[model samples]
Target: MSAQLDRESSENLLSDSRFFFEKIWLNVSLYLAFKIRSVNAPFWVEDTMASSLKPL
Candidate 1:
């Protein structure tokens, strides 16, 4: 029982970290796309980020 609980806890931690990691990246991407405007970035970066920004 303790081993199962430990496994579940570790899995939860892994999942939570992944969730936060993705959330942070999305926020960073959005910020670069709009806030700072990623002016010096490559055209593809701006284009892709711009398209993705519409859904949010």
Candidate 2:
């Protein structure tokens, strides 16, 4: 009985660890994507501004 409980507890711990790792990975991916988008935004805005000014 004790051995069975130990196995169950270990399995639960592993499952929890997997869930935590997945969450961390998702957060990192989102952060990187946000950073890339922010970095590109100013360049896009500048390009649009330059094109608009060119016709004047």
Candidate 3:
């Protein structure tokens, strides 16, 4: 009985830690993607602006 309870508690702790790490990973990936997009956005905007300004 006590052993079973201990096993259940340990499993729960493992799952909780796994969930925490996954959440952190997700946040990190999202942040990196946003940073990459922001970094590229200015070049893209500049190209569009320059092309638009030219007479066809």
Best model per lDDT: 1
Ranking of all candidate structures by their lDDT, best first: 1, 2, 3
TM per prediction = 0.68, 0.71, 0.67
**lDDT tens string, model 1, 25-46?**
9888877677545457677777
lDDT of every model, 2 decimals: 0.82, 0.74, 0.73
For 1-56, candidate 2 gives per-residue lDDT tens digits of 99999999999999999999988976776666566566766777656645644643
Error of 1 at 52 (Å): 4.0
Worst 10 residues of 1 by lDDT: 30-39
Q: Total clashing residue pairs per candidate? A: 0, 0, 0
- What lDDT is reached at residue 56 by model 1? 70
Error of 1 at 27 (Å): 0.6
Among residues 3 or more apart in sequence or in different chains, the pairs in candidate 1 whose N, CA or C atoms overlap within 3 Å are none
lDDT of 2: 0.74
lDDT of 3 by residue, 1-56 (tens): 99999999999999999999988976776666566566766777656544643542
Candidate that scores best on TM-score: 2
Q: C-alpha displacement of 25 in model 3, angstroms?
A: 0.6
